[model samples]
Target: MRTRTARHAAVVAALLLTLGAPDVAAAPAPPPPDAAGTADAESAGAALVARRAALAAASRGGGASGLDFGACPAVEDLPSRVRCATLRVPLDYARPDGPQIFLTVSRAAATGARGAARQGALVQNPGGPGASGMHFPLVADLPGWERIAAAYDLVGYAPRGVGRSAPLSCRDPAARATGPVQEPVRPSPAYKMQRLAQARAYARGCARRAGAALPYYTTPNNARDLHVLRAALGEEKLTFLGASYGTYLGAVYATLYPRHVRRMVLDSAVDPDPRRVWYRNNLDQARGFEGRWRDFRAWVARHHSVYGLGTTPEAVQAGYERVRDAVARTPAGGTVGTGELRSAYLQAAYYDDVWPDRAAALAAFLRGDPSVLAAQAAPDPAAAAGAENATAVYTAVLCNDAPWPADWGTWDRDNTELARTAPFETWANAFLNLPCASWAVRAGRSPVAVGAQPERLPRTLVVAAERDGATPYAGAQELQRRLGAGASLVTETGAGSHGVVGGRNGCVDRHVERYLLTGGRPGGAGPPGAADYRALRAPRRWFVAPRLVAVHGEDVGSEESALGVS
Candidate 1:
């Protein structure tokens, strides 16, 4: 579900929109002020407490009853390590005592310098809404995670319906295209019919396979589950580091259970407004991709001799358009279609480290190299299996949590408007989500509207970048305005990328680490404007190299600053 914005260091910041539940029907009531100080924090913490009791009750006796692990698991005759266990919760929170599912949990105890242990467990989530956090303590060395690892028994677990946890699987392989081959033909009966068919098939297939568990996969349930995990871990308060969707999860948890929170960090946040979750978030991602595209175009323009893309940004863009047009007319090898090309592009848009490789791949494909495009189209069995499970869970949770407009007319209008600007991904994205229109379950409670009001709660630190496209910088600003005194937003200037930590901005990481260790939030709360931020230029962009996709263009790259992570 992650969306690539700009090529920042490989920081975890992708904004992914997963499909699962139906629309929310009832909006939760806003909490009283003097509850939690600051609007954003107050709203978040309030929402959290409201669901704690219900979620806690659901955690007992569904499928994972009476399961517990005290210490790290020792797979071999090896040193003592983190422990692993399971906790059962209802598949549907509405029926807390009904059919239950097991959620996987893992913990790594602290081992500090001189053998001194850190205080509480610092739980971390990698933000796939699909990624596994079970190995967080093991894999936390990625870029900028070491600071927190030193002082806490790092903890993480897969959200229900995800990895290691009992998963939901999509049976249809046809649904797993790298991208959509079907394009919208304006005023065409065939296109409309095809859209309806694809939408219905995806929805029905998911409902048939996912069943009742769909209703229970919302973020609220996950927040509630964390409390059970907190209790099971013997910690009175929880500390957290959640990036991307994990940040949303963290925000929900804080909103629901203020007292249970010791310290928290929400990086690359989401729409605090529940109703706009799908709409605005997707728009943000589109803009991010466009911005990155422009950046790439400019970079390519500078190397005209090498790329043969003309010595201007406009020319580079024209060259890319030609490639896209070719892809649309004739799918590479008549099999590696335009859909595959778009998917490759989308993946490249995710990080700074892979920009060069993706650029190279696209270049090759444009240059008539069928194998390059074919390779992009090829699917790996393991990845496909994981994708099937991930997609099923994502769909089940999204469609079941809240209802989507079943009306094709509304979608048609919305997509038409969206495509006017975001032509690159608009239709393809619409097709990708066509299933939501026909999902089986009806909608649930509508998301609550949290107003800005201060109350009693621990001070929290929020991190975001100025140029961030996926989770726009404005979200952080609004969140800060809402939180007021109790929260602070540390704007990571110019740094771009999602889901990556500690790679691009030392200042940002130091700020986060200071807060985690000492409970201090960002200082010098500046006015919400462009002037308040600074830039942290990334050293690279991550993704597969772009193949030579254009027939008449020369190879690009060969620049000192061309797509390498520092």
Candidate 2:
């Protein structure tokens, strides 16, 4: 394996060459010597307490801001008792009074506790740079989080350039959003060119549609807006729960406003190393996904008695390749492409809960049924629209935050090189972000130095699944290190799920719930020399098909099982 130092140096060099400027921010200073580190840890802990006290003193007797609360717009997933409202913030912080954009924010007020007992707001984000998190307050509805909901008002929002908050669009809303099957690559120069063209066209569309607001839709600005949301909600100190890309946002918020963080839970952390902000991060994801994909292949092989695809991992790969080749040769039902098939299976890599269904789909298709594959690829009009917007916002944020390799050659070279080793979805993901090479706006800003002032941060709980592809475990480790002695990592060992906290892992949830509720942390829960916790289990939901609805084994009425498994 390549050393992190070597990887860092290589990526930085590529970034400099491509951007024609130094975009990689310097990493924070190394950890102190053991004896000094111990002293520093003690002093940092003392400093944190004093800082919290000072902040509390400064904001004594402060109450809610004047922002009016109204009933949230009803959505399918949101529970009752949720309130929402819109707030306006500057489009660009540089010129605060220049232009204004609105943000939609939601909150589920504490139900378990009253005034003095309530623990302020517990804000959360659900990862997408493009994904809308307006319903994240729904975390309050989870099994172990009800108490947390009672103590802290669960807050959620649609960050700038996502959802109803000045949404970014790169296509004509009236134009049919073609849900084409853009498959994984095979090192073909022609396919490479097609992706480049598509990316360039996409870039052009964003430039024409996104207009001047494009440049400001960045991570730093997003962090600043979060602070504004904090003020609007009248929270003196922030208690954050962020997952996936959200982990990065929360980290940046802490970096800029460390004094304001009361508590933070970063689940499935993004690498804080500035050099890997995005370009390198995607490459890392390709490798990370490869490992999980193998796990999935192994699982399917174990269940060969049912699916009959293969009896071993290597055999499973052969089956997968055959299925992939079929999709490419003839788009399933003229709708699904090899790309769409690969994309669908990619979900299984993120979370194994989909494994049974995904494998079943493959089995059905291999048996001469294209309906299963075609249905999966078919686009729901509204979902497709939302996906398009997300792609737009995702592009804007990453491109604006840092410089990507300027030339198509760099992308082609890098991705093609990566596909050789990690072939699953390398080309698919590569083409997805290829627009960055031709982005409309250039913020010329480097990603924030998240760990620059480690001492100022509170004792944050950073969680990760050891085998998470989206936000790999190594990134979480790096994050904990940068967070200095105050941070304790709680990694779910051998678990490949992207985000695991509320996904039904008791051990992980116990640690998270205890921390969010009783100010607990996860130290000493890990094996010696490992992370603070080593979660060993994964969630598996297998609903055996039943012909009758039973009330404690007494049949009330006959009902067909939704899942086909009998």
| Clash-forming residue pairs, model 2 | 183-339, 526-532
All candidates: TM-score: 0.77, 0.81
Question: Tens-digit lDDT track for model 2 on 52-164?
Answer: 33223222211144446677776524445668878677676545446778888878788864443687788877777887666666555545666777788878788898889
Query: Cα lDDT for residue 51, model 1?
Result: 41
Model 1, span 202-294: residue lDDT tens: 777777776665555666667667766666566666788777767766666666555556667777766566666555566666777666566
Q: How many backbone collisions does model 2 have?
A: 2
Write down the TM-score for model 2: 0.81
Best by TM-score: 2
Residues forming the 10-long window of minimal summed lDDT in candidate 2:
545-554
Badly placed stretches (over 4 Å) of model 1 are 1-67, 70-82, 114-117, 140-144, 173-189, 325-335, 367-377, 450-454, 525-566
The TM-score obtained by model 1 is 0.77
